[model samples]
Target: MAVHRTVEPSTSELGTFTRQNANTIHGHALACLVAADRYAHIEHEIKPSLHAGDTVICDRYLASTLVLQRLDGVPLEFLLDLNADILMPDLAVILTASPGLIAHRIAERGIRHRFHLDPTMPGREVDLYAETALTLTAKNVKVLVLDSSNATPSELAAEIADTLPDPR
Candidate 1:
């Protein structure tokens, strides 16, 4: 199994820029940077791993872009166009939780990004993710909406694994 990320390698210029400037960058520019990083990630990591017969699990992908960039005031159509050529996942698992639970978790972890600064962000993100799930489904992507409000991470992983088609 090979686990890839949208901003890959961690040391690449694109990844560094996206991470370091995420809070300060404008939405449109950030979206473009993220799209570029994704394409690079696919070429460098995801494709190679898949060709080697590894199961590539991406931590975040187009679904996340659709939600997060939209939260940054970028339009949905713009985001869709930005990410139009990316590799679609066979299974896009969207984990959701109640707003209260989400807020509590964010509070416990401390804020990592500008989005976490808003009091209403947790609710908005949950709602957006729900909407994103439907959008992905309409695009013919297999989506698994899991409620993580009460389940342990191990339990969630088990459920996700079970959802995968058997190899044999």
Candidate 2:
């Protein structure tokens, strides 16, 4: 089982996030998310909040930058350029399921973010994530793409843990 990190952003950090909040300009954040600088900032400012050697299962990360920036008309190369030097995850997992299945899941969960506001955004996100997986794999990054159509989170986590290299 993975120990997930929950980094509570300090008031300053939260202010930074809110001040540069991507929602200000985009049709909605999903369409106009500017996550280019967030990856670097997190490592610089929030890394201390996490355990020294824990696996950080980031919810939406650099790939989110790539997708959202592209959606917002930023060039892929430009967006990737901004985040090229940021530390990559050790075991990146891309969960996949049918758009229908994902739609149902989101419908039940009720999101607080812009990404889930539009029903069509989920479909776009899935396609973008698939492309992102291919991009990541090409860079020699190890990625596990799992279909979460029926698997529970525990089962999925176990599958992922089994695939990860031993910490020792």
Query: What RMSD, rounded to one decimal, does every model reach?
Result: 2.0, 4.1
Off by over 4 Å in 1: 1-11, 166-168
What are the runs in model 2 whose C-alpha is more than 4 Å off?
A: 1-20, 27-42, 45-51
List model 2 lDDT by residue over 30-135, tens digit each: 3223343355446554464344555555565666666665655666676666667766766678888888888888888877556667788768778888998888
lDDT score at residue 151, model 2, on the 0-100 scale = 94
The residue-by-residue lDDT of candidate 1 on 1-168, one tens digit each, is 444444332346877888799989969999998889888988887888777876777777888888999999999999998888888888899999999999999999999999999999999999999999999999999999999999999999999999975442
User: Measured by C-alpha RMSD in angstroms, how accurate is candidate 1?
Assistant: 2.0
Q: Against the true structure, candidate 2 has what lDDT?
A: 0.65
lDDT of 2 at 129: 80
